[model samples]
Target chain A: MAGDGTGGGSQVVLVTGGYDHTIKLWQAHSGVCLRTMQHPDSQVNGLEISPNGQMVAACGYQHIRMYDLASANPDPVITFEGITKNVSRVGFQKNGSWMYTGGEDCTARIWDPRAPPQTRCQKIFQVQAPVNAVMLHPDQSQIMVGDQSGIIHMWDLKTDQNDQLVPEAEASIQDIAIDPAGKMMAAVNNKGNCYVWALGGQAHPVPRKHIAAHHKYALRCKFSRDSTMLVTTSGDCSAKVWRTSDWTPMRELRHETQRWVWDAAFSIDSRFLFTGSSDSYARLWDVERGTLEREYCGHQKAITALAFKDQAV
Target chain B: MEVRPPEKQKSLLAEQLENCPNLPHRQYLEYAKFDGTAQMGLPTKSFKIFMTMLPEKHQNYPLVVCVIANAKIKDLIGFTCYKYSIEHPEISLGSVHDYGLCIAEDDGEVDWAFPCLDSNEPCSKFGFTCLGLIELKYKTVCAAPIPMPEDGIAFHMFPKAADSGQSHQNTSRHNTGGSQTSEAVISAIRAVNEDKKKSGDVNLEKIQSHIMATEAPQYKVYKVYLLRKVRTNTPVQLGVSLDRIEVEPLVTHKHAFWQSRSKYFLHSIDSVAWCQVLETRGNRTTFRIIYSPSHNAAYSDKNISGNTSFFHPNSTYKVHDFECEHDMAKEIVEKVNTILDLRNSPCRREYKTAKEKKSQTRRSFHTKHLS
Candidate 1:
């Protein structure tokens, strides 16, 4: 990790962004913001901390910006432009060799981030509707892309083959997640429903469970690092944790002023979770106790995306 | 190169045509081109556009929105009040041209005028604006109460696979004692008859009437919403009457005196009915109301006077009951209304007549309102 400290395995880093047009890095344990980077171009659409913890990638309207984590630079070290619409989601491959993004342009793209002057989007997978979320499985072979047409497209990177599934015809797929173990996958949609599938040795994912996770539109779903729990956030102003064993609700994390929760991330230990909400605050909660543990308050507006990396467990 | 079957080739061509059509029409109803008015309103200032679905039951649900932003002041103007059908999600937003709400400026001066969020229809694609400029955007994460109540009970019945098997469990709630009162039983019977019709099956009214005829005379007062299929602005008053299990609509007929005696019959004049789900197939679900009119008969020794007509025909009205799947059935039921005004109900008059009889006989008497 290329941060301020020497090679320490126990070092932790947290980053978040939103409508305030700024990205803030935090000390995960202390909740103190260490640095603030101005993202004045557009409100942050998605955020991802690099696998090695040396950089941060923030996707916005039409640009994907990369900032060096160790440097106090006020400007992005690399910026990829010319995207036709909002770049809704961005994430790095496990080895940080390339980056993947889904956007309103109805495409999920692979970009060669290592290309310094020109970040060339290497490949594009077109779909029928605007793309909302993109996730790479832990196996590092399949990319899951979800779109506003309520379709989830699975692209096999090795074979260059793809398949699609429409969980609900009328609901737009908002977010998707796969467990760290790569044994299961969960997706939440605009209709407040969550669908889970069991991943096997074969290519086809078996349908496991369907949960009505919220009353209104569901914005995000994430699996805990340990894979024992899943969390879904919605417009109803609450985040619910579900046990992976039975898919039953575990706890409801709610705050009076938290209008809409936009994003969430699990700590490396899977014992804690951090959420960014439209209430303009990033909150940490003990997943087991379902209690608010800490609040990282600095953004002047709603926090739309967040990323966290903790000491390797 | 690989060889393919003729059918496969045809399907591949069809898919290509679907993706690269020469002509295209609007796929979504909420399409509105941003005419640079929003850009001009706040050319330099940046503001976040946060959106959340207004709960269905909220009284101030905005249907037709007229967002007036002060371009010069760079401030938001609040939404206005209006009436709209929450049921119309597929309708185009531009179809309705009313922006009736007034923007009440609070606490200060204002400048330029601009409209935003004016689309009355629901949208699937919340497009993003340019990089770093004050542009329209969608919130990425949403928070809510866990196990959202609106998540609508998994209703696990996927029409085809579970069509006949164990699907009875879905109707178990209607059979429970709490929901099986006379009114519910009547509506249930009617609903079954209508459900049968949708499946293109014969009406079950014959079997229903037979079952109702076998039951002993156990008349009970039942209260039900009477939605009249007429040109009335509102539903009639809640109907309180003797309930029967028959699936036939109540028909009332008025006639003159006969054989020096009085007579009245149930004819298809105006009666109240209750709404219930009738069928669900693919994306469509149908609802229906069964109309049953009550009859008041009188008799004398000179000659029995009353019209006894069996197998009278009653009408059934159907409506589309499908909304977004997340919405509960209860929400659909709430939209069905009462047709009669409460002031016109016969309960007060019946009480007066019963009171006069009690005064003459000096006996303890009681009256009950089913609702």
Candidate 2:
């Protein structure tokens, strides 16, 4: 009876935003909007929580703003305004020493979070086209940069050597994900195709499986925290979870009215999942039962980006 | 009894979770492979190091450190630290205890003595025995600590005779046998070569890789200078501001790569301007050009007009600085462009939503050449 509450009764921090131009912090158990912060400038493109859970970063058109999670300050404490074009991804290093971001500017950048406003970006990895997604591998040494050009660049932070691979020709790489075990990698393209690779200690990742996840454009693909499941959301108005043991379909979460699913985040235990959709509501679904557990209903516009940092393992 | 089709057996829940909600291997042991590797000369005097979770109050995240006996203990040889994410635990952590190489002293023992005055109480009071110090052999990814120690203690290295084929073949083999010894040797040599050289540094010439022997210069953090031209009635007077950005790049690519390019050069004229080397007389460097007159046209063609609010034709300045700080300058330019972009592409009805833009991009993606 101790774990009877919603979201497995874990202490979770959930932040969601989108076209509403507002970011709402939610209480995971009750689905209540604990606080609302006005973005005001532009629709949030991507959101992330710092490794320490003290700050929440939201990336929009040409700007990355960091809100204080420990306090009730509505205004952003640290604002990165100078990034040109739309920033599609924002993430922090495991130790919180630096942050990494990718944007439509055709580059992935590393920035020191403690530095002053003028001097933040410390390193830059240039790609051929506008980058769609940027991810840090669990090994913490390599950064996965996925661009609209369909090329995924594996940049080694220790050696600064970059290796590139093209999964499909003319297919824009929308998102890239490496499992927590560092054993598998998944990349979803705009063509609604998902490519999986079994990674080794070597530089290149070998192609494992190709899943036609969605009929329409695929928006995002993420691996569960346990590395047991892979969830892919698409414009086809459904989110499909695949078992990692075998590339077999486990469940397809769909709603009649949901137009497009933009983003998804898994709970700490990997038993629950939270997804933000174009319907202007973020819903939590039980992964095992494939059922809707709670609905966070406050945003007036589409929920495009969300960041959830659940209880530490 | 009729057998179910292979497809029909695919259930709603995962195969392992369908019958029993709790997984059988909730906390499974990720074994280390010592196969193929001859344990002939492997050090046998290992200890039971206690690792306890560091409190949330003392640290930002939960980090467990192995507590080893001090250098004074005769039985103490050397120890390694292993870390895995508590949330997303790896199924099989190939190697349990392996980090940088520890060169042995004259007594045939590698002494690892790190300062533990502050760590003593935390380990004894709250730490638990998470892992044991054992000889492991496997192919695994290892993490290199950032901001490495400035000076490391140098010990007399163990002779290479112990790793010879003759010695490994004579030893009794265990079940944990595999082709893993060569990898450990490779990593140990890498650690030795990666050691920074100092006055008292012990030369690891025998174990060093030939590639590392070429001596690539280590990366260094440099101070940036913001040079601006002043027009105070007289000719353009040079003004150097010391409160500039901080950049850390390898010495080889020091002056050419700036992580932030917008802060120092205009995107349109960046190619033409950076090619020209300004006068560098006695540390007094002339300004290149960091700020451009307007946002690039590639960005303006999306939805709205150019960002005319922040850009003025006459306000562009020349920036002359190191390439390390050039990226920082690009960040500044990006910030300026964002402010200007807000003026033209505000959060209004005229601007398209993300969904619309995504759809448009998808339509145009087919015609676009892949990079």
Candidate 3:
């Protein structure tokens, strides 16, 4: 389970299914299992939290689902299942009312939670190759979709328009983030370089800094709640913390198992970092001292997805 | 008196001195012969006075022995004669040993002017003229003066003559010498003194200027603005300025016989909303504002107030409008201006207001400025 850095007022825990095909939720700090939900047919690949933290979205093989925490026994209240292959990543609107999902089918679809099921599964974007990652703007007005071709395309959700494709990396773009301030965005590539782009004022996204964020293929990249720090995990089995100042590496935590660290998240207070690795375990570390604080073990196979909820339920 | 041969002139001058009485004749003869080269011609009256005053040894060796006794004497006499002649150029002389001992005892007037060998100008100095004539005559009569090995006459006498004051001045006029002038020496001393004075004054001025320009206490200002969506009664106005705001131009669509103009505004606001402001001016204005996100409520309130304003808890009315003249303009300009004004005000005056002091301490930590 992954918890956000928004603090103890409300905390969100997101867990993805491994080979078991069952996704579970537990208290972020206490490790108490809250609920367990089953996916349809395939294992869960990715999970995400909307900016408002009111809803949790999950993607599995060929299916996309969103669960509203406000409801009891909240099953997949909204389901999109037209993809030819398993879904890889998913993102939600800032308001938590809509979500976009990408999959191995080489297409990205936008879903409206308010729309009836018959009209909800809408294909908003399609690519030549399978989509691997997706990120939504903090304002919920634009969506950035990345595919296997290493190309990132920005789509204006409000205008129903597609912007010019941004050449992000020579290799596949694995993960992307728009900072809390919405002033900057960071994208990690398969080659381990994190490219940051400044938004607004300019007609196109301009690269602000290129950071050698990881030693091996970077699996996930995320910004802190305050946007002062960036955390990234890599196949090199280490998680690194980078300060925006000079884009210098500030801290690093290496796991003894040497498994590919698939994803990482910062706690709401920015005091702790959690990593989900291929070893089927999630480890929590002190952000400042780089000390391992706790480890949670339960997933039957490689832990592929992680997301954090700041508000406590 | 008898005329002496050119070579025997020294002996002849000594012999004639034997009959001198007024002065020591042998002494006179010794003085003249010691000079080595004797000139012809002796005055008779001066020679008689010289014989009567002769001492016993001078009387016995008046002629031949006098030459030997006075060998060293000539050098002393030559030096004195050279000095006097150069200083008093009006005196003149014909030759050494002329007028014999009579010339030594009786102070006879001598015209010292002698023609210079190089310029053919008459040299009137008694001593310098005699020396010059001796040098010229020696060069003609002999190979040259056989300078002493211990003290070379060429190194001492000839070089000294070439380096004399007049010779130096003449070389300087032609710009051929390196000797410095008195005026150059004086100016160099003055320049060194002036430089010392200037450096002392410059250092003092620099210190005074630094003290005068010492930095005053400084502060930062953060401006917060509010934005709301249209239509809902419960407008949720977030107390933060939009990161980027753009107002689109009004566009008219013509369909059939009807035309409608629509103006749309776009604002992008981030999650965080805080700005830093100086302590002084922050007290005069409210720090926070409440806004209802519903467009209908905001429009109705804006219409009633006849201005764009946000809700402030402390104000009498629900709405607080900034003193801006433009009705349609956004609150960004007002918020930014307030922040600038607050930051520019003095820190001490700002402390007098309780509200300003509280907000100032809340935003930033007060610490000494470091350079």
Cα error, residue B129 of model 1, in Å, equals 40
The whole-model lDDT of each prediction reads 0.54, 0.54, 0.47
Off by over 4 Å in 1: A1-10, A116-119, B1-371
lDDT of 2 by residue, B1-371 (tens): 12121121222122111222211111111110110010111111112222211111222212212222221121121212212211112211122222222222222222234212222232233222222221212112213212212221221111222332321121211111221223333333333224313222335642242212111111122344433345222111121111112222222345656533323222322111121234545544332433332333333232132224244553243333432234433433333232222121212111223334556467546435341
**Candidate 1 residue-wise lDDT at A202:** 66
lDDT, model 1, position B45 = 17
DockQ comparison, 2 vs 3, better candidate: 2
Worst 10 residues of 2 chain A by lDDT: A1-10
What digit string (tens of lDDT, one per residue) describes model 1 on residues A1-313? 0112211122367788988687887655434355667686699999998888888899999889998777755457677877989999999998899999999999999999765334377888999899999999887888999999999999988887999888989899999998877888999999899999988576688899999899899999999866888999999888899999998999898976777998988776667788989987787777777766556655667899998776542
Cα miss at B65, model 2 (Å)? 53
Tens-place lDDT digits, model 3, residues A124-189 = 687777788888777667788877788887877667778755545458888888776677788888
State the lDDT at A7 in candidate 2: 21
Model 1, global lDDT = 0.54
Give the CAPRI rating of model 2.
incorrect
Q: Which stretches of candidate 3 lie over 4 Å from their true place?
A: A1-16, A50-54, A68-75, A165-169, B1-371
lDDT of 2 by residue, A1-313 (tens): 0011122122357899898677777655434455666576689999998887788899998888888766654456677767779999998887788889999999999988776556778899998899999999876888999999899999999999999989999999999998877888999999999999988666589999999999989999899877889999999988889998999999898765566999998876677788999987787777888876556655667899998876542
* DockQ of the two-chain complex in candidate 3: 0.00
